[model samples]
Target chain A: MEVKNTKAYEVVIDSIKDMVFKRELKKGDKLPTERELAENLKVSRTSVREAIRALEIIGLVESKQGAGNYIKDDFATSLFEPLSVMFMLQESSPKDIFQLREVLELECCRLAAKNIKDYEMDRLLAIISEMKETDSEERSSILDKEFHNLITTTSRNKLIINVLNVVSKLIEISIKEYRSQIIDLFKNDRKLVEIHESIYLALRSRDEEKIIKAMEKHYTLIKQSVKM
Target chain B: MEVKNTKAYEVVIDSIKDMVFKRELKKGDKLPTERELAENLKVSRTSVREAIRALEIIGLVESKQGAGNYIKDDFATSLFEPLSVMFMLQESSPKDIFQLREVLELECCRLAAKNIKDYEMDRLLAIISEMKETDSEERSSILDKEFHNLITTTSRNKLIINVLNVVSKLIEISIKEYRSQIIDLFKNDRKLVEIHESIYLALRSRDEEKIIKAMEKHYTLIKQSVKM
Candidate 1:
């Protein structure tokens, strides 16, 4: 019973993946028509379509209205659906996801320390200054997210940014849950402001070790306070 | 142009994410009706529907034919799309992807070292034995992949297993490319067989450090042979 649910579509997907792996199907390679795939695999076109939709959701393939499905060279945009689903289903413990976030964000901070340009630094400072004036937790959270987003952007690697974006979204849900919890725990808005300021200073100083240390400290505090 | 692309859909997505983050939209909570959301956001129902579809694709919400969408409790499956896309797009250099695979596989080996039971160990050994006798490169590769898949399954974490599955698929592509570039790279089937045996022995012995070291060595050799 379990095999029927999982195996049929998997077989079709694996066949296509194998073609991609073998370079028989390169990026932008239009798949054989749906009928052809069904004939080749000895499976119903329904199963083939299911596999194709799954692939499409995952960003491996894209379908146009008139044009048939084509392989995507860039899979980032397509990743949102599957990633969103995985985050929802895993009952993923908050602690584990947060730990993963810390690792990724610390790496981001280190990269930003080394690579952030003067204009970016100026912009970051401006954001930090704006963050200092914001008292609303909702606004603060958005600013906090934007700060991290900016750090990732400055890293200038689409892969890292994409990863950060996904992980951040996953944790952002929990962060929102813990918003009041954080406010109650910290009580001192100044402390939160200081943490962001310190992180900004470390970035501006271009001290890789210091930046990693500060970012780690910031997340460690949040982890402790949230008890995730 | 870039800013324009980041439009209402993203805003709606983020707003829904905020609700999830806040625990306002708990698992199994029925989301706001599309009409209600459209009214609240001052957007067309069509736009709201588009956002909902995007969310559904990402595993954030599930929609039934008669019923409205409901929040998913966990997100393991939804993650496949984005992670796969990132793996394909960011992995510009095959070597970078291979390095990531080595890191992940080593982690898998370490996890398997302590956890693999006798039946699992036997299954792994049988896979290696099959690889030793398999004359077809295609068959050998499938066995090789299954061997790794077995280890991931034994890890007992869906998130880790899913990520490894994506990595393995990417590695399959890399391996095929490598084979094309260097004809007969797998001709010395005996050496490949020995490497798997060594890894299996490490797993059997339940030696975490040794398993990691062996997996790393094996991957390093693979990287050298692939050279790209």
Candidate 2:
């Protein structure tokens, strides 16, 4: 029966999932060849291949003409196909997306403060310094993205980082609208630089409360300033 | 240049996105034929079709071999592709996914409390009553889905509903695992039924705090009972 066959596939998928969760298999780790997997699981090669193909479509594995299938590390590309369509259908506004971003980025900031490595802190400081040197709004925007990307990376939660990355890309197409609305919020680039400095200090101190407060202040100010 | 052409296609996509967002066209609504769109937008049919094709991949529209493209009501199919891929790549645990579900469904419960219609409440109650009569685990699971679906519909936020629907599907596949845990924890169907009743009462009262509290209680119990 159709149901029985579906159940068989589900069992196959679950076994693979368990291995990944147990870390017996890891991200970017190559899975066994089809024949090997079938033999190990006592399933038909057809079932094993089907499960692998399904996982590939979902962005778990990449199969090339010659190269074996390799596990993917990043989650954003996997999310893009569905999220792009959802955003298109929902026609989510910049404001609505912004609200979601605020909730997520604030959490990221708090987590990064607690968990960011010294090297990451150095990189973040360098990015901020680079942003300070850039006079062009265009260059600054790119630097801004890098800054946020670093913060998200340090959050150490794949789901959060993936969702934030998708949201960032979706909003990138509308950056002009966002910029036009908030162009005058800062008196000069120095004020923006100063805010980043304060945030950096809070992060360096590993002060969770301070980090949350700083992030809230930064976002609230930006939101208010943009309204002008 | 390639850049210029991509920009033009983006413009076409944006215009259609605006129409959909503004509710000028809804799910199941037919779009103007490709030729009509080309004439109206002053773009080539090729450009229009390209944009539509991109949207189709994301699940906004469905084009039949003979029938024109129809707007899609549910975002499930569109969202599933990318999310499933992300799940596989991240190899997310049920706990991680459950955390997301908890946040999302709790939000849905709160929103439904404020917005659910009398008919919708009646439908939800009907499902619960039917679930009580059903001896089959499969039927009970179906009724459980309907209960959550009703709440999502009443939330009146398409974006939330779309995200929740995708999560719901993933959860459905794992419900047996979740149920066994809950059964182990509570050991009484009556207690489980009471939790749902309390949630339903919170909705009827339209008390946001009560809804949130009820959801927290329900999820906390679920978290304790379920094997993540």
Candidate 3:
């Protein structure tokens, strides 16, 4: 029964995809209104609505009130926000999320080592130092996010940044109730500070081999502290 | 005006997200009906419907025709179908998509090296042998995809497989008209077979360093032939 419900909605969406494949619909093109789409596709208005809604969520369509839904021109939005919630529900374990994060962050650090500017390096180093000085859990959390965001941004790949940002949010949700990965990098302050310092130093050196080592070390410490 | 349209729609969606954050919603939990959401949130029923539609597409919500919508229990659906459409339109060049595919495929090869079974090795070796003999362009293309898919499945990571599958589809769409990356892995055939052979051997041996070198070789060939 539930599967039927899934199919009815998917049928409508597939019809729409067919239109895309045939070049009948295009990016930034306004979709037909609900009634028209339902009538044309011979589906219920409700199904058409659901299909378009699903398309919008997948970052392919954008809804404009009083106007209508149009195909999105770019996918720069927080695509993984809903994706994160989906993970939070399905993946009871954080292993997949953690592994995906590690892969992207390593790539980010490797790229950052090559592309990071002097000022960006200074900012990251300062974030590490601030991590050392901060005693508040809230402060540690903020500094930790700032530290990674700076590095991810420095990597200069919008696609990686987009996906990584969502994965990081998933990580944040997992540990928000427990302790964040940063809070446990040492289970104490000094070790946490040093672990991050190593990352900062690796980026400063701009050595690919050293960057890989430093990134792996960072994940190892976090994985050790993490339940997963 | 465009900005206003974007915000009005976002407001309703943000309300739904807040519900998730506040613990008012749980996995597989049913959502309030459209009227209830419209009234409580003081938005139009149209807006509420659109919000839920967006959520459903993100794999965070499931809708039942008669029962109502529920927070989705899992996210194994093709979340990237629309995402691929989004990219096919926005990205005029395939550089970003190509780079992303390279990164994920490299990871897949690394994991496959460690996890692939003897039977899997035999199957992959056979596929490569077929690739060498196939003179039909269509057959070569299909075999090429099969070879990659087998390695990816052997990696045994659902999340990687999920994301990679979508990324692969995006690549297929990109070259569907011009020529696939595989078709161009070598403008001529022998180089293509040799390149993939290195990858297969590296995997069968399960040597991490060899796998990395082979994977890099594979991408370097494609990139040189690729306009990007």
Candidate 4:
């Protein structure tokens, strides 16, 4: 972000943020040119360049070589940056990530139970049967992710879905080996399938208490595999 | 981030992430020098600088003007960048944000009920009483944030606390005028204090069902004040 002075850099950043917050900047909108931004905000062209660079770094702004800066259409990509930084800093433990997932995934189950459509229920039923019949661990893990994702999507809350996806990815990344260790346990057991079946059944029944209980059981099983 | 080629820049970025994910780089650790990184990754020095700059803007790394880059100690500040951008893009509505908060705050209530300390409970009691006595809308709002923060902290989950803080800040920012509209409703109504009292009382009881019910009522009231 081309700044020798952090304070001036931050001031320019805040000015751009004010523009966005006030709705002067919008989705798919090109940022004002460095010269125009400098004149508008009373900052140097270098400072404006640094501000645009900062936004580009966060995945919020894209600097096309000749076309200039445009805000990205998708915003969720920016969430991953902070999370990765947190993981790198060891600010959060593997267990902390899992606990947050349990908190969120349970809510997903609750909301999904209330909001599931008929076709979605049929799809869930078919997935469960296929899960029960599958002997491949790779397929089972893929199905596991799908089942949870479908429930999260059914919650009908974009924020919840987005946060859960980020947390789940951290779970996969931060505890990469342990997750595989848990999946490996399935080679000798059918308990994974049973836990998911209970979750599906709980959702089908549309009982909030049962859904929470079932989801808690699912998390409990997974938590056992986590050493710390 | 300086780059003419997004593809090469992305590759450099991914390589740095891989280093962090694998724990090859760590907190407060300086990144490899430009030439070193370029040589090691078989990429250009410009690509390495772009990658470092990308990390720098995300608050993961701080580039000393004369020295080099080191990872930042605090990671949570980085989260606001994306949410603000998302709010600017209208990817998430104020309603979606509040819904997510409800999901999290209710879960926090459930966990806090199990884990809250006596000192914290005593503190909450004091705040609630002060909230009831205070006629100032501003004071009531401050107490409101305190009460919610205490419960979220007591949940004893770092990831949840960090994520909730980010969402709560977004609610304050994205719905700045709307939030004041709700707070303005508190001038003639003691309903805000009463709602918080129910939450505090439920926590004291440590009954999961009561806690959930009380928290639901709390959110129901707030959601009603929201125009959309």
Q: What share of the true interface contacts does each candidate keep?
A: 0.04, 0.14, 0.33, 0.53
Q: Provide TM-scores for the models.
A: 0.60, 0.65, 0.78, 0.86
| lDDT by residue for model 4 (B4-47), tens | 55466566667677778778878778877777778776778776
Any runs in candidate 2 off by more than 4 Å, and if so which? A1-63, A66-82, A106-115, A121-134, A174-176, A186-228, B1-63, B66-79, B110-115, B118-140, B201-210
Tens digits of lDDT, candidate 4, A1-228: 344555665666777777786788888888877777787666688767766776776677888899998877666644455565565466577667777777788878888988899999988888889888987767877787788889989998777877775566575564445647776666553787788899999999999989988988877777776644
**Where does candidate 4 clash, by residue pair?**
none
lDDT tens digits, residue span A1-228, model 3: 123555567777777777676767777788778777777766787778778776775567788998998877656647656655544554435666666777888888887887899989889888887887878878887787788889989987766676665566666775564455555554666766787899899889889898899888877766677645
CAPRI-style grade of the A/B interface in model 1: incorrect
User: Residue A66: error of model 2 in Å?
Assistant: 5.2
- iRMS (Å) per candidate: 5.3, 6.2, 3.8, 2.3
TM-score, candidate 4, is 0.86
Model 3: per-residue Cα lDDT over B1-228, one tens digit each: 122555455666777777776668777789888888777767788888777777776557788889999887655547556554544454434666666677777888887887889999999999999999988888877777788889888877766676675556666765454345545655566777788899998888889999989989877777677645
How would you encode candidate 2's per-residue C-alpha lDDT over A114-187 as one tens digit per residue?
67999999998998889788888888778777787899889776666656655565656555556444556554
A1-228: candidate 1 lDDT, tens digit per residue? 123554465567767766764567777778888888888877888778767765664467888777888887655543554464445455567755664566556666766777888998888888789888877777888887788788978766555455555556566777776655767887856777788889999888888877877887787777778775
Tens-place lDDT per residue, model 2, B120-195, is 9898788778877777767766776777778877877665565555555456656667876686666645556667
Chain B vs. true chain B: TM-score per candidate: 0.81, 0.71, 0.74, 0.84
Candidate 4 stretches greater than 4 Å from native = A1-6, A76-82, A174-189, A224-228, B1-6, B76-79, B87-90, B173-189
Best by lDDT, which number? 4
Q: Weakest 10 consecutive residues, lDDT, candidate 1 chain A? A: A1-10
